[model samples]
Target: MRIVIFGGTGFVGLNLAEVLLARGHEVTLYDRAALPLSAQRSLADYGARLKAVQGDITDVDTIDALVAEGCDAIVLGAAVTAGEDLERVSPARVLEINVMAQIPILQAAIRHGVRRVVNLSSASAYGAAGQRHQILDEETPCDPVSFYAISKFTSERSAARHAELFGGDFLSVRLSAVFGPWERPGSVRDTPSLQFQILAAFARGEPALLPAPGIKDWTYAPDAAEAVAVLIEAERPRHRLYNISSGAAWSALQWGEAFAALHPGLECRLAEPDEKTFIKLHGGDRAPLSVTRMADEFGWRARFGCAESAAAMSAWWMQHKEWI
Candidate 1:
């Protein structure tokens, strides 16, 4: 299969590219940012199977030309992960990139007779509803509050509507808090994951100070990418929307401690009273997302938990500490 991933230079895109390339598929990575040297060195073993193209996502001509060439599948991973600060500074930019830009891409996919289109959404789409509900499923109502959340929810609806009207195979997966290999600070992504923050502190030879026990269903990036790959290749998906998550909540502080155990002389603990901390949690803890739909349909479940992900990330960090 030949697949194209928008925002391919970003964290999740790179992980998905590696997964697909390892499965003996051709992959083209389309992104605004050039591929990082670190990624180039790591992906060198794949040879010509991987191609990275730098382009503006909003440029209809470029996107159309690329899709027109040929593609077996398309994964919409481009997004502006804005927080309140960015939302106030540039709200329209968020909408333009996260929502409006998707229209032309989907249109091109439809025109070119693409097989499958997978829209990468976030659990942030759940918004306040995530906090209110004890368990968030596909049927749960969403009251998205942040600009990022609103754009994600809007993108999902738009993709579904396009598929319904045009008879295209479009599916959206709402991913839980994703943190693992390839996650780094970038222009579009304002908030780094808690695990990233903790590991960054470790890289700097400092104690990881936590504001709180940041607990949520933190999905490892590789695991999340594999699940999205499943949806892209599924012959007949039972549902249009599905939740991808670890399906269990655990404290990121615990993960830090686990990593600390692997490396001696590193401190991972809570901040003292009245002490300032650099670590930033995404938001207050919310209910974990239910993976029942994915499990039932595809026999998929996240393999990494708090401890396992910690160990895996520790090994990755040892090799790619410069990425921090």
Candidate 2:
């Protein structure tokens, strides 16, 4: 299959591109800038199966040509990374990149007759976890807490609606804390409550900070990439919103202890956040759509556990000197 990925040069996009290429599909990566050195290095491993193109999502000509270049599916991974200050990328720009850009692109795809589309939505859309006990399934009403989440949720709805109106299939994957190799710099200092926290602390030379004894599911990048692939390959009705997460919950202290044990030199601290600083969890009680949904239906499984994923990421960062 030939696939075109918007924002294929970033973290998630980069990982997904590799996954698609490994499956022997022709991939065209359209990003705003040249592929980063890390991504270039990884793509080198794929040789010629992948084509990396630098292009703007706002450019109609660019969008048309790329869509016309022909692709069986399109994955929209292009957006501001979560945790970014919404004010940093003004609402106009956020709406432009997250929502407006998709209009032209989706129009192009519909005109070009692309079969399927996968929009990468964020778990942030559900706001802080643990705010509610019921799991946020596809049907849960969203109360966006930040500008980033608003843009993501809005963009997803727009694209999915467009696909429905135009006679095509669309699926949205709401991703949890995704971490792995080729992770962009920054945030290595203070990781999230989930997987990246330990890795971040190690990278920043700070003691690891674990969350209060609260539960949150952090999905590894490979699992997420596989989930997207599974959605692309799955038949229609089965294609609605799927929560792509590890489906396993762990507390902050547990994660911190595990991480501290892995690296002897690293200091592990049990520090609580100040009153002003609090972490939010998307607490949904419902078991995420069972993996059976992905396996029996789409043939997908998470190959790495949290500890295993953390170790693998740490090793990669150490190898690249990214964790210095």
Candidate 3:
């Protein structure tokens, strides 16, 4: 299969590209940012099976031309992960990139007869509703609050509506808090994951301070990528929406503590009362996303937990510490 991932140079996109390329599929990454040198070196083994293209996602001509050439599947991973600061300063930019730009891409997919279109959405789409519910399922009604959350929810509905009206095979997956290899600070992404922050502190030879436990069903990037790949390869999925999650709750502090134990110089602990800390948690903890839909439909479940992910990510950082 030939797959095109928008925002492919970003964190999750690179992970997904590696997954697809390893499965003997050709991957084309379309993004404005250049691929990081670490990623370029790591992906070098794939040879010509991987291609990276630099272009503005809003440019319909470029996107459509690429899609028309021959695309078996499309993954809509481009987004502006805005926080309150960005939302206050550039709200329109958030909606434009996260919502409006997606329309042309979806239309191109439909026009070119692309087999499957998967939209990457965030668990933030659940918003305040997440606080009310114990388990967020695909059918849960969303009450999105932040600009980023609103855009993701809107994109999900727009993609599903386009499929419904045009008879296209479009689907959306609501991903839980994702953090693993390849996550880094960028222009579009204002908030780095807690795990990334902890790792960065470790790299700086400083202790990591936590604002809170930062508990949530944090999904590993590779696991989340594999779930998206499953959807792209499915012959005919039963539903239009699925929740990709770890299916359990854990704290970033726990993972950090586990990681700190691996290295004698590392220290990860909660901040003292009223003490200033560099680590920033996204928001107050909310309900974990339910993976029942993914499990029932495809027998899928995230393989990594707090301790396992800590070990795996520590090994990865040892090889590519420069990436942090």
Candidate 4:
């Protein structure tokens, strides 16, 4: 199968690109930025099976031509994450990329006869309602608080409305707590991940300190990529929206302990109990997204838990230190 990832050079997109190639599918990554030389060298062995191209996703004709030229499906992985530290970046740019950019992309997908379209939405769409867990299922009403959250929810609605208007096959995946390789601070995903902090600190020969309240259901990159791969391969999707995740929550203590055990000197410690940084990755129900729908419909489930993911990611960063 031939698949095109719109933001293929970013962290999640790069991981997804590798996974799709491993599945023996031809992948063409379209992004505004160039991939690092290290990543290119690591994936060089894939040869013609993998490709990275520089293109503007907002360009309708280019997308239409690319999709019409033998692309099977499209995965919309392009977006500016939550906060860009406006002092160093523009504020409205986030909304511009996350919310407004989906219009032309969806139009091209529908017009080009693309079979499947997967829009990468975030759990933030639920806003403060499900921040503390609340077993935030797909049915939860969206009350987006932050600009990033509002954009994500709005993007999903746009995709659904477009599909309804044109009778096209478009879907959205609400992903939560996803962190792994190929992810770093960039134009698309600017937030730093806990895994990267731990491993990067180890690489710098220092201990890592994390915020309090512990995080849960952190999805490893390879695992998240594999789940998306499975979804893309599904012939007929039962639901337009599916939550792809580990569907379990864990604390920073678990990951910290795992790192301590793996590397003698490296430590993953939580912040002071009274520290205002006592941030919770999940809320209410303390559960991430429920993968029951994905499992039932497409036989997809996360294969890695916190412990396994920690160990695997640690080893991976060790071998690919350039990524850290």
Candidate 5:
């Protein structure tokens, strides 16, 4: 299958691209700029199953043509990341980049006879506080507090509309905090969050950040990417939204400490806590639209489980310092 990925230059996209290529699928990456040096080097090592095309998301006709050129499906992974300066970025910019940009692309794909589209959604759409492991699912009400979350939610709605209005098949996956190999340095590096801090400090040969409260259900990137590919290959579903995750909880410190134990000299220490940073973990009643559905419906399962995957990532990063 020929699959097209937007924003395939970044960390998650790079991992996804590699996985798709390894599976013997032809991959064309559409991005505004050339891939980073590391990505280029890795692509060279991985051979030519993958290729890159330069294009802006704003170019509707170009995107249409690309989709029409024997590409069976579209995977929308492009988006401006979360920002600290929300006001400066503005809600308008978020809508333009995340929401509006996806519409013309999806419309063009439908017009050009693309069979399916996999839109990447986010857990942040639940808003500022979680309902104590509320088991946030596809049916949960959206109360997006951040511009990034709002944009992701709005994009999913737009994709669903495209599916309903134009007969285009679509699957939107609400991904949780995703981390694994091929992660870009500086993106999560030095992050105040306990897990990343520990990972980052160890990477830098420093002390890991140890904290009890920073928790998240971190899906492994390769696993997450595999889920996206599976959804694209599946039949159109009555239920269009699914949460792709490990669906398990762990503190940032727990993850960091475990990784730290793997390597000597790297150790973890607690930093001063910030009340605002605590995540409201969702609860059990919700039964997050399990990837078990993907498994049952499409024969999908995580290639790597959470803790083992995190350790693999740490070891991979440690060995390939040049890649980071």
Candidate 6:
């Protein structure tokens, strides 16, 4: 399969590219930013299997031309993720990137020979639907709180509508807290993961400053990538909106403790957030994402827990030292 991923230089796209390349797929990564030097070094082993191409996603011609290159499937991983800072500074840009850009991207995919189209959505779309502790399934109502969430929800519906009218297989996957290799603080996605923070603190010999009891269903990047690969390769998928997550809940303290255990005296613990600083976990404890649908239908499940995932990331960071 030859796949062209928009925003392929970004965090999730990089991870997904590696997964597709490992599975013997040719990947053309189109992104606004060039692949970071660190990523180039890390993925050098893949050689010709992966190639990063820079282009403007909002341009329909660029999208059409890329798809015309003969792609098996197209994954729209391009978007401005959840971030208050981004919303405050450039709310309209968020919509322009996440929602408006989808129009041409989707049109080009169907216009070309691309079979399956995957739009990366976010669980933050749940918003107030996640106010309580209950696990959210595919059918859960999404009440977007922030601009990012709003764009994600709207994009999912909009793409589905387009697919209905144009006739094609389109999917919107609501991803949980995804973090691991290739995931760094970026302008498109600035939210830092608790695991990465802890690891960084250990490396710097500093105490990790975390929001108290930050808990959510965190999915490792490789696991999320595998689930995506499965969906892309599936001959027949019954649903359009699917949630890809670790399928289990974990806390900031747990990950901090796990890292501390591996490297003693890291002082991994939570710190109360003042008005200016914090990690927001307003969804409360154990806000698990119900992966039963993915498991039951596609026979897919997340393989790493918080501890194991943190350890794996630690090894990766050791090899790719410049990422942290």
Model 5: per-residue Cα lDDT over 1-324, one tens digit each: 888988777666788888888777888889886777767776786566788998888898888778778788888987766555542546576667788999888888888888878888877666643554457766667777667778888888989888888888887888877777666534312222334445655656656544344566667788888888777767666578877887676665666667767777776646556522222222112223345566667767666654587578777776676653
Estimated TM-score for each candidate: 0.99, 0.84, 0.99, 0.91, 0.86, 0.94
Give the better candidate number (4 or 6) by TM-score: 6
Q: Which sections of candidate 2 miss by over 4 Å? A: 82-84, 128-130, 185-197, 210-214, 235-237, 272-296
Screening candidate 3 with a backbone cut-off below 3 angstroms (N, C-alpha, C), the clashing residue pairs are: none
In model 1, the Cα lDDT at residue 156 comes to 99
Prediction-by-prediction clash tally:
0, 14, 0, 11, 9, 0
Q: Where in model 6 is the C-alpha error above 4 Å?
A: 272-286
* Per-residue lDDT of candidate 1, residues 1-324 (tens digit): 999999998999999998999888899999999999999999999899899999999999999999999999999999998877788889999999999999999999999999999999999999999879999999999989899999999999999999999999999999999999999886788889999999999988899999999989999999999999899889999899999999999999999999999999998999999988999877677889999999998999999999999999989999998999
Summing lDDT over every window of 10 consecutive residues in candidate 2, give the lowest-scoring window: 185-194
lDDT for position 311 in model 6? 88
| lDDT for residue 255 in candidate 5, whole number 0-100 | 66
Error of 3 at 216 (Å): 0.6
State how far residue 202 of model 5 sits from its true place (Å). 2.3
lDDT of each: 0.93, 0.70, 0.93, 0.78, 0.70, 0.83
Better of 2 and 3 by TM-score: 3
Question: Which digits, one per residue and each the tens of the lDDT, describe model 4 over residues 59-110?
Answer: 7677677777877788999988855363146557777887687788788778
lDDT by residue for model 2 (17-91), tens: 888888888888898867877667757877777888998878889789889978999998877653444435455
> Where does candidate 1 clash, by residue pair?
none
In angstroms, give how far residue 293 of model 5 lies from its true place. Answer: 2.9
